[model samples]
Target chain A: MVNRLIEPTSGRILIDGRDISKDDPIALRRRIGYVIQQTGLFPHQRIGENVAVVTRLLGWSRKRQRERTDELLTLVGLDPARYRDRYPSQLSGGERQRVGVARALAADPPVMLMDEPFGAVDPIVRERLQNEFLRLQEQLAKTILFVTHDIDEAIKMGDLVAVMQQGGELAQFGPPDEILARPATDFVARFVGADRGLKRLSLSRVGDLELQTAVTAHPGDDAEEARRRTLADPFRYLLLTDDDHRPIGWVDQDDIPRSGVLTEALAIPMSPLVSRRTTLKDALSMMLAADVVAGIVVDRTGRVLGLVTVESIAAAMRPPDRGVGAATDGSGPDAARRLAAELAARDDQELGRTEATRA
Target chain B: MEAFIGVFAWFADPANWQGPNGIPTRLLEHVVMSGVAIGIALLVAFPVGLYIGHTGRGAFLAVSLANIGRAVPSYAVLVIVFPLSIAVNRETGLFDIAFVGTLLAMILLAIPPIVTNTFAGMRGVDPDLVEAGRGMGMRGGQILSRIELPVALPVILAGMRTAAVQVVATATLGAVIGGGGLGRYIVQGIARFDYQRLVAGALMVALLAIATELFFSWLQRRAVSPGLSGRSVRAYENVAQLGRVDVPAV
Candidate 1:
């Protein structure tokens, strides 16, 4: 309806404030970018021409089209020199999808309509493309109405997700965290699946949480002092740090010798290393893998900042961003509340929260 | 071997090279008549094919015409137009009665392949490409010219190639209609029982037909973008150019 590919029998679609049904569909679509699963590249055209199709359509000069084509290809991580002259048949599925995105972005349209653009590639390639597109989205920030059948993809890609039922009826429209925390309908609740609370864990990042300061000791420091400090903290684990403050590993308080200097060999197995941008869900999963209470949060240089415990991840599960949506839902928020409370009560080694959060 | 020697000697005879009914005169006559017929066929079939192919309208008509063309023989069309040529120089600018009959027959014979192939090629273009073009705000004319035309060129040319070859081979019957062409050599050689001229005429027609096929192949390579035909062009040519060769009714 946005592009008016098929006219609606009822209802109007508005872009800014005006109904697009009244607007010239050709002109309206020109202001939007479009990408599809097949990539829909003109097989007769070169890669450079395919990327710059919209620019060429918009009457840009030949020189400008060439420059923009090269620029967009490079932005999408394809080397313009290598790929520009090749045909669509010459590129891989992933490369063709990138060109589809690049072509859509060619005219710098304010709105983008993407229909399962990454669905054609294998899972690993899809993940990489999704990450690359997300990074690019951070910079470009174009409004995208992405369509996908996979609910996991919806939860991952969309900031404001519109869950459509089987007949194109709007089931729910809200932010990913909100919908996950509190789905509008049973269809949506079922659509997001039983693991919606765990899915919501992906929404909040480690940087957003106030991490705990674990008891720290250098390799050459006194083991007695380190043991005392570890015993004092509620976590009861000494984080071994190097001279650069980069974490070595975790050390149990009982494992520390009475009066000897703390050596590098005294450290037990390492906890998973996490960065600030790491999702709370991933952080929790990583902590669960090592059967530890905490994940060491690191900076870009891999220097330890602080520790994110299970409690922080549980706290993030709450839907803090609802207005009218708080009243309509039945099971989502209540389930999330019970799971978060249950999670908050567990010990650091209680990584069995996954099996317990059935509600 | 003896018959082949006589044909070579016929070619070496300078007498066959001169005069209004000579080799050069007859060859020019053959090319002009066939060339004019092809031009007219193109003018008639090309637009109708594109219109039907692009709009997806009148497809039944194109299919029916193609089927009818395939079912009817070249001699049958020439026979059908045989009576029509004697009537009144129907439209002005027509020169000679046999030329009129043969030209009409050639034009009729040429229409179906050009129309069928053009329609097939145009419709063969992926609809996704057309949709993408429209979604990108390309106008109807722009889509047809820029996307559909370039992509469908090989198929369209293949149709033309078939039509041209068929017309060249069938033009041999123009000599039976009392018209001038390389066909005259075969007709006169047969009538005079001159084995050499008869073989020579058949060989010359065969050579012209081969040259037409190669010329179209080169033209297709030149006209179509390499990107489109980069890998499967040879395969596509084999598929589309099938059944084009017709044995002349000598």
Candidate 2:
């Protein structure tokens, strides 16, 4: 309806405060980016010409169209020189979706309509495309109306999600975290699912948390001093780094020799490194998979910044109080409180178990 | 065996090649008549097939026309058109009666395959492709020309080939109405009870039919997209292998 592909029978749709019903559909659609689930790429045309469809229709010169095609393909992370001349049939499903995205953005329209654009690919590819799309949206900031039946995807992708019921009625509309935390109706709650709290973790990135400093020592450092540092720390472990400050591994206080030099051989493999851009959910998954309670956060240069513990991650997921750590910043105190309540409940169960044993 | 040798002897005679009623003249006449009839049929049926296919309307009309064309034999059509052509020529003071009657019969024989194949070909185009073209802001004419026509070209060419071969074979019947074609030799030889002329004429018509089939098949291969016509090339190879088996007998 926004692109006027289908006209509304009763209500009028306004874009930029102008009623679109009265506008010429072709002229209006020219200014809007439209992408469908199947990618809808023309198999007969090369990727370059497929991406340049709208530009050609708008009377762009051949030189300008070629340049724009390359630019759009490059923007979607496809190498223009390699992909430009290839037919759509020669591309993989993920590559086709990338071309589809590039084609929709060819005209650089202010608004984009994506209907499950990444839905056709496998799960791994879908996740990659979603991350790439999110990164692209961060730069483009185009007003996009994304439609998907997957609730998790809705929470992850939409800055503001509109939950619609059967008969095309709007059930709720708000930010993803807000919609997840407080569904407007029973249907909305059921739709968001019971694990809404866990789903909300995906929206927050590790960059949003205040990471705690981990005690560190250089690989060439004196073993006595490193041991003292490791023993002093509550975790009793010291992270070893190279000259560039990139983390090599961790050394337990027990593993530190009493009178020798700290060497690379002494350090054991560390948990997976989490970048600032890594989502909190993914970061936690990495930590769990590595059987470690904390992950080292690194910068783009791979230099260690600080450590993110499960406590801080859980703290960030807490419910909002005084608008601090709300969905806007992906931090809240409610998650910490919820964690405390669960711990207390566990303790009660443990106490009851002991009493039953005595009886 | 003796009759076949006599036919070969008739073709070898230089005098038979130089006269007004020579092999070249008869072959040229046959080709022109078939070409003109096919051209007329294309002009008449192509638009109707295209329109019906693109709009998805008048499908019943296309099917009915095809069935009717098949039911009416070319001989019956020629007999029916003879008196109609005479009356129309008298009223309009135009059109030679014999030529009009013969052309009408060949045209009726050619329309069914052309119209049926063209309609089926256009209708078989992927709807998603058409929708994609429209979604990209293509006008109706652009979609038809740029996307639909190219994708449907192979099937349409197949239909044209069918019509061409059928018209080439059927044009021989024009000799019955005094139309100038290679069929004239056969009709004259039969009337005179001359076995050599009859065999020679029959051999020439058969060769012409085979040559027309091969030419259209080559044309079809060139016209179709490589992606769509992969199996066709292999199918042609199989037919060629069969042709090799028949070459020894010749």
- Displacement of the residue B10 alpha carbon in candidate 1, Å: 0.9
lDDT string for model 1 (A1-359, tens) is: 67887798998788878899988888888888999768889887778888888888788999999999999999999999878867787788999999999999998999999988898999999999999999999999998989886677888899998876655567788999788887887556666776888888887899999988878999989888888888888887899999999999888888989998999888888889999999988899999988987899999998999999888677666556656666434467787785575466445213222222211
lDDT of 2 at A321: 58
The local lDDT score (0 to 100) that residue A157 gets in candidate 2 is 89
Whole-model lDDT values for every prediction = 0.85, 0.82
Model 2 spans with C-alpha error above 4 angstroms: A77-86, A215-272, A300-304, A321-359, B18-20, B225-250
lDDT by residue (B131-248, candidate 1, tens digit) is: 8888888889989988999999989999999999998988888999899899999999999999899989999999999999999998886677665765554443354357332221
| DockQ for all candidate structures vs. native | 0.49, 0.23
Put down candidate 2 lDDT per residue, B77-185, tens digits, no spaces.
8898889878888998888777787888888888888888888988988887777677667778978876777678778888888888878878788888888788888
Chain B TM-score against the true chain B, each candidate: 0.90, 0.89
> TM-score (chain B) for model 1?
0.90
lDDT of 2 by residue, A78-149 (tens): 999778866677789999999999998989999888888888999999999998999999999999989887
Candidate with maximal lDDT = 1
